[model samples]
Target: MKENANSALKIVASFVFVFAIVGVLYVVYFNSNGQPSTDVPVGVKTFGSCSAMSSFIKTNAQKSYPSYWGSGVVRAFTGVTGAISASPSMAEGGKATDYSTTNIQVAGVDEADITKNDGKYIYTLSGDKVVIIDAYPAESAAVLSEIAFNSSTERVTEMFVNGDKLVLFGDKTDYNGPIMGAEISYRPYYYRTSSFVKIYDIVDRSNPILTRDVAIDGNYYSSRMIGDYVYVVLNSYVYEDIVMPNITAGGVETPVAGCADVQYFEDVVDSSYSLTTIMSINVNTEEMSEKVFLTGNTQTMYVSTDNIYLTSTQYYYEPMPLVGDFFPRSEEKTLIKRVGINGNTVEFKAEGSVPGWILNQFSMDEYNGNFRIATTSGHVSRSGGGSSNNVYVLNGSLDTIGTLEDLAPGEQIYSARFLGDRAYLVTFKKIDPLFAIDLSDPTNPNVLGKLKIPGYSSYLHPYDETHLIGIGKNAIEAEEGDFAWYQGVKLSLFDVSDVANPKEMSMVSIGERGTDSYALNDHKAFLFDKEKGLLVVPILLAEFDAEPQSDWDYGEYTFQGAYVYSVDLTSGFTYKGRITHVTDDSLLKSGYYYESPYSVKRSLYMDNTLYTISEKTVKANSLIDLSELANVSLPYEGSDYYYGYYGV
Candidate 1:
């Protein structure tokens, strides 16, 4: 009887122990929120080397929980291997090849002039290399011919076709010897430079000739042609000097400033220059002139029939000023100045100011008799971070028209466009959404509707008044150490005929997926062809599988390319075809051999050709004939450059 009783007691104790263990397991699993379970061994250090802990768990633990058993085993093995191969393998260079048999003609030009002329024209700065390609119905278009420029390395900064004259501006700067002696190379100095503006007579496209070149002290940033006068914005440098002195203590010497009676000194001045001028050139006589339009720090300018609008932002610098030292001052204000063009005098009568941040993004459109300015405050948050979507509207006189109500909490606007009686705003969050507002009444705007999507829509293009096109996607990172490139390019079409209820019609994914920066139509399509539509879009592709660096965080990663797509708004806004990267073998080889670190700069569809600018090359511009690639298929092979610097 005693032996049987002892055995029963032992069995009850075993049951109790098993029940306690089960309860503990249940609690842990419940706390994990349905995630796979992990072992927490007693007396074992959780924060120790992952590989060591993994090995311990594998050896000591009788069995892993069924839920996390696979992941736990894989992690343990991976940790050991990762520790052994802690150092990554060296990356290799990448090469891209043409997989298609189609031939795309290269116009042999780097950098074409982009102007919203009748259509767009690709003018090679090197020579009279002009290729007029059609942008309408992007497919089935051909290049007109190769037109040559008058000079080599003329470097056209701004060009506009005004009736019979092609008004152009060129900048050439040469640095004199060091402002200070080379022996005192650490010191800074300021030097003067010169630039010029030229006008060309292109009345006859076949026999275009340079009319005149006017010398100026500053480089021209932009220009506009009105009547016989060509208005130009010139940028010049303004220099200032700074000094610093060294102090010593005993004759043997202490280099402290407060220690010495007789001090040895060194003067260090920042000899940098700032932009400061606006000039006008008479197209008829080619004479250069100036106006008294004083600006603080201008970034952009726009001119209409009645007034000229100038956007300026205040620059901030560190190091507060001492009593007698020349320290930088903070101008806690942003200025939007409007000047009236009375005769030749630009009367700056109206101005407006905003607090804390400067103007970083803006869009201007004229409605009725009033000009509407949609401006966004710089990404300056109270927490000292960047946000892109705070939007404000201004009137023609630079007055605060109104501010758009913030659509989503913590969401900021990326872009705003005016279409007929309404305005479309693009905002960025986890995904992008289109907010439609009725602007028939400029003062009291109404949020008529909204549309949201999975990716980012950076730019919006409207076809007629009923249809809209959006270009957007999340950027992809290049490699382990490099930045994130663009990824998942999607083109979405929307029907906005009903302002209150906008609907998405269709979407198409092109290339490997990328981003679109700009798109336009040729003059023939813009003016005459209503039945057939032509649209040109510039697309920049992100490197495959590119991701952000582990340490740095500045969400900018993109690869450059130009894509021209044709849209038919009448038929569910269908995309016809695309013409991209149609160039000579030599040019393609050069582009492949020389990779640019910066994004693709600009693309313009003018006359009948497509012009593209490569930011990677010093003077990278290419002109391509659209007709050659109408039937060509783009190759989708992988890149050869493995970005990893593993072995080296």
Candidate 2:
């Protein structure tokens, strides 16, 4: 989901780079051009030497901020806390079998997720540990091994399982809690966060051996695994003093990106700046490659087999004389930088810009050598004024070739999915408008059809070439504002066989006003199999017996589990059964209350048994009938930080 403009922070950084007092600004000066420019720089320039890099940074650092900088205040360093395709694999080189893999955008490329499996075993990150489960037969499923970290200041975010190798990514921060003295001492380096990657030889599942451990100075952004190569992205903030990001591997530390390795565009600059680094490691050979780009903070990343696209939102002010030009209008644009990847080698490819801001990584795609993107141009205010959606096609060189503008005016794009030559977009204000776009012409793309509905979908998944599955919320149009009041969690099946007339074949709504599902926003939480005609989503059902006080009144949490369904073209969605990790004891003690640790967050199926995973337990059930077969308790305990308290 996109962050609201009013709440989003504006970042500006100026740092003394390398061995000098000279400062460099990663931001572009607003005054350099009187108006926004469509003439985005084509290629990136490399800082050939430290002196050249220092000079470039120094020149940009001295540039003035945007005209609308005063609209938001800058607060510094408050040390406050905080799919249809199953890859058939052989277990131990045995007979080839079928098991569900990560639902990824690109076919060959794999995305990191909380849980991963390889036919016989399941690997998941439970709190601060990586639990490996022997999950072949449902009746005998059990936890095999676990790797734990320091629960005080370390966290494992996600991981990938490839054959005998298991790659894990996480963060380690220095600041555990706030100082408790009568007089608090604040330092610039009070909070230091570094992202780390660990590779383990899981050939011995019972005793996984750590082969390599590497740490880099930055916060984890995103990661992808392709074949034997895994790519990790990190964003490191540049402070007032010169402090280059470093990489520590095998007990030796080195600069992740030296002055010579850093690249930037002279024509692009924004308020937010960071050292965006992309690191590729060969899982088999343990070889690593790194490249750094000086740009605005990385917002959304789209990785294909050949390239990785990083997008960052850039804002510029336009003088509106009619509104007293003194208050400049903030205009948003997305800066896109593409880096080509071949095995373990990653190289800077091209750079470009789009007129509007993208919703997420799903808003961008690459097909048949052309790059496609969907964006929202103007800001949508409370009055629903002057906001429109757009789609732009860029060639291999990152130059605009085709344009589709002013789509669904007065509304913003809520969900987008690109399949082959067609794109599906959902935009909303008071109701949802699902647009079916034809991109076969590339240059003259137009809307083939549009379907208006009551609510909007935050995520769209392809059921097939001619169908789609949407998971979001049901809603009612408000009497006053241009927005709608969202209610129960909703699932809709769309048939797009007729490009000129798309239709919602069937739909289902769950719970009451405050119901939600993790699949709504996170695609990884969604599971579907065409062969088995199965669909699973983690749902948090909220319902109340008392009438709602108002449209905004929320319902009480009544259920937390995975909703299983049998979906088909003829019958739409058939509610199979639900699986819950919450024990009967907890349910009786708290009534309808929610237990954070028992909330099911992910679900996966292995052959005949389905696995529903929570922080506290992994429950296995029969795929035919939702009967519990086995349950394994996990070693995760809620911490003070998780309960909203600081270190105590």
Candidate 3:
């Protein structure tokens, strides 16, 4: 994975000003009953009325976060579709019983992805529509049906297919009028953003029935599906007027949260406030439930089978008023709120504060009724700030029972994964240090061993109980600096059977600098079947005809497709074959490197057939030798193109 170098620069830039960028942006509201007369949960406070909620917003916006403003929005596409090639008669008669599922963190909990399969059929997004393809047997695959979305302002990010039901998660932005009473000469339009969930009955493959359409106020954060329930999280921006978000089901619209339904922690003093809303939907029955909380800013969220952990970054600024100028120093902390999950009943359980910021969802884990989190502290905004990493083990009540602090000074965490009784962490500055931490003792977590290597792994996956797979970038240390210049995508197999000594068993590098892969960032893009010794990664390969003159030199884009490898503990990664959706004519017309509409983004296997999917095509190949078997082209090819790392 590519390192984010701009973070250090942003911290340096913040020192020139007294008031830094406001972390909190919006308020999230959910439709619920009036506040209960009973006592609120511990560490939770409620407004209890509309007037009280409005008063809190006014006081915080004016006195505490006077410079708070809305943050920027991000927009991206998933996949599109084209047409099918082979006939239905060419397919084998029966459905495949052996198939692979999405790569998820926990066993029972499922994460939404762009592509999913049910052995016999494939479900994926194509432009603004959902395309269902009859994919099986490798010989014949055809487009079964396409469901086009009518809304232009909405984009479905991902979906989940359970049994005969298809649940789609989307984001919609509507022009909610203009901002009033602004100091500017012109009026700025305000767009109300919300997340929507649409559940469809796919009992009949050619035509899907829409059973539920739910629109919740706020921007979509992330979602998880477990068993019959789908949990969606959203973050809403709060305005001074205290415009509340509405929960619209079918057609009836209700205010998502009144003052009484809103809950907050009195201990967390954030510069601004955000209304974080979490909703649970029963996909089978179309029944929904929601809970809203006032948090610092919803950052990294980790959900297990029993609970959801939401984390937000909190900043403490110290003002230094000089005779003529002012400067402010700041420190960073993470506020974590744990919410219990039981069917549709979502309630706050505990709250904890840690000394740093988390990397992502993988930075935290839950096991044996305890929560473990890894974070990086120092060097956020302070001058001469040296970086350090730490891990905290919290019990059910969110109390820190064990801590291992200041493990790798001047280095930050690149990736982390928690297995059954051990935790693996990778930190990198000039070299990647893979640390094995013992977590069997919840009250005394400590590091057992460390392995220093030349590159870093941005993502880690447990191959089994004793082995692991790492996907990241290969780098070489710069001659004059305390850092390394990343070269290419690196895949490694690590043997961790020896809890006290971890070693890189085998490794391979692809392309050179400027090469990229979707699997490096999104774990869903990675396809691994340990039983079959198969691993597939969607990569955009870059290379050079001659040796580079400097360490900063990058390679040119040469190939774009999926790299198939047979990986194991003994032999490591062995190249099997490569699959590409780009045609030879298209590559030549665009100087040998064009972001083809058919750039493969994901891969899956059903029995012996491997399916490589992209925006415009889905091709099936033989799992043994990767020989082309069938080509299924989707109908709609929209104007938007995935430019890959080489942007448009």
Candidate 4:
């Protein structure tokens, strides 16, 4: 449901890279004859090597800033004092029946999350540390070690596993907190931020040796891993006016002085002191490469094997730009920039714009060579009350080629999924109305069919090529009010076999009024193995005896754990019951107040064994009957770092 969701591009197929380094001002030195204009076209500039890229950044640090940064930028730095090994960087897979990896959205693409398992070990995020478990041999599963952060400012939140190497990404904060008191030269005060990136080699089960560490002056944005290369995005708010940024490599603090070749885009963004940086590093390489571009906060990102898309949203108040009006005519638009990447090399390929903001990563998908996006425009705001939705298709160059807009008025997009040539969208106001769209013709898209259901699905997954499963809330069509009160968790199976008449073949819901599941929010919590017809989701349920006698009707914790089910196109959904780590009645007595983020945040399998993970325990169950096999009590369960999963 939540992630730091996050490339390189070639300018042209045959263009050879030239390192325009020290004293080389590519922005001003070259004139627009046969070369690029002062306002370069939206494309990438390649550095022949990592050293060249660093030199370019160091050389052009002054140009990296917009006109606004010179006067009002803020700067502050922190030091990490923990011991780090200086072993030489060494580089870098395996099996089917591996119970599938992480239920990724796309086949070859890997998304960073809190937990990652390669069928042998379960690497999960616990507070500020990563706990590695020998999960394969279920009965003998044990905690190998805990990888902790270097300082109080370091928080290891997300990670991605590439073969024998584990790349952990986190943010580095200053203990001093936000800069306070009077501002110098009339500039405002803001908090300083940075990023913490570390890679480790875990060939030996018990001890994981840290191979390399890279820290930069920016907050981590998002990341994706492909093959042995990892691409991470970092965003920095240049509050302090500094000539160069404070960066670190290995254990020594370094300066981004000689090679800060920051570049700018032709399109102007109003905000100042914003730098968007993308870093690409190979697991086997000792050196890391980075490209810094200028922009505002990167709101949404979509990454594929070949391209990385960074999108930002801006609100435009029209008709009243020059004059003051009580109710201004305003609208929101999202700007999308595409970059092509190969290993550590990144290039800007194309750029485009859509009407409104996207819901999540699933809202945008590339089919064949065409980029497809879905956005919702207009809303019932103080400015106006009309609402509209759209589906836009863009070509390789990011030129809007076709559009299908003005769909399901008053209802914004609740969930969307694109499969091959078709897209399924669910929009809700009072009820969920699922729309089926055809994208066979890029220039002219059409809505083939639609169906209305009681509730909306926040997340959608393909059950098969012809069917889909939606996870969301259950609701009764508002009995007396215009809106529905969400209750429990709803699962709907949709059959899109007939493009013209898609239907919800069947559905099932669990829990009571206050019940909730992590699957409804994060896609990572939802696990599905088509080969085994198995579906698992971590759910937290609260229930009452019946309708409340008073306005404040409180419910007690009914169940907490993962739910197992069997999904089939022919028979619909068959329940396999629940799996919980709560062992005694004493824990159950605690009830409603019971809060544990690790209380089954995720579930994974190695062949036939199903492992249910909680902060305090790890329990394996038989895949056939849902019977408990062997349970292992984990350490650090008392650590306050553990919080409720649904809080975020």
lDDT, candidates in the order shown: 0.40, 0.75, 0.75, 0.67
Model 3 per-residue lDDT at 371: 95
Query: Which has the higher lDDT value, candidate number 2 or candidate number 4?
Result: 2
Candidate 3, residue 391: Cα displacement in angstroms equals 0.5
* Rank ordering of all candidates by TM-score, starting from the highest: 3, 2, 4, 1
Give the C-alpha miss distance for residue 464 in model 3, angstroms. 1.2
TM-score per candidate, chains pooled: 0.56, 0.86, 0.88, 0.81
lDDT of 1 by residue, 556-634 (tens): 3233344545557545434443433423333322223223222233443322334343322111122233444232121
Residue ranges of candidate 2 with Cα displaced over 4 Å: 1-82, 91-96, 175-190, 319-328, 584-595, 640-648
Q: Is candidate 1 or candidate 3 better by lDDT?
A: 3
lDDT of model number 1: 0.40
lDDT of 4 by residue, 1-648 (tens): 011111011111011111010111112111112122234443434334435543333343434322122233321111110000011122212221445466676666678887887777788876556888877667777788888765567888689877678888888876444345534343434456788788888888578888998888878988888888888888775454342345688678765422234444333333323456777878777457666655555667788888998776544433333244333454666678788878766767777787876777888898888889988886533233467788999998889999999988877888989888899999877789999999999999999999987889999899877899999987765455456667778999999999788899989987766777878878888888777778898877777777765423445667778999998887778999888876544443234222564468878887778888776667888889988777866664344322222221
Q: After superposing candidate 4, which stretches have Cα over 4 Å from the reference?
A: 1-97, 176-190, 240-244, 256-260, 319-328, 380-385, 479-481, 548-555, 584-595, 637-648
Candidate 3 per-residue lDDT over residues 478-546, each given as its tens digit: 887577899999999999989788999999999899888888878888888888898999888878889
Worst 10 residues of 4 by lDDT: 76-85
lDDT of 2 at 487: 92
- Name the lDDT value of residue 343 in candidate 1: 33
| CA shift of 135, model 2, Å | 1.2
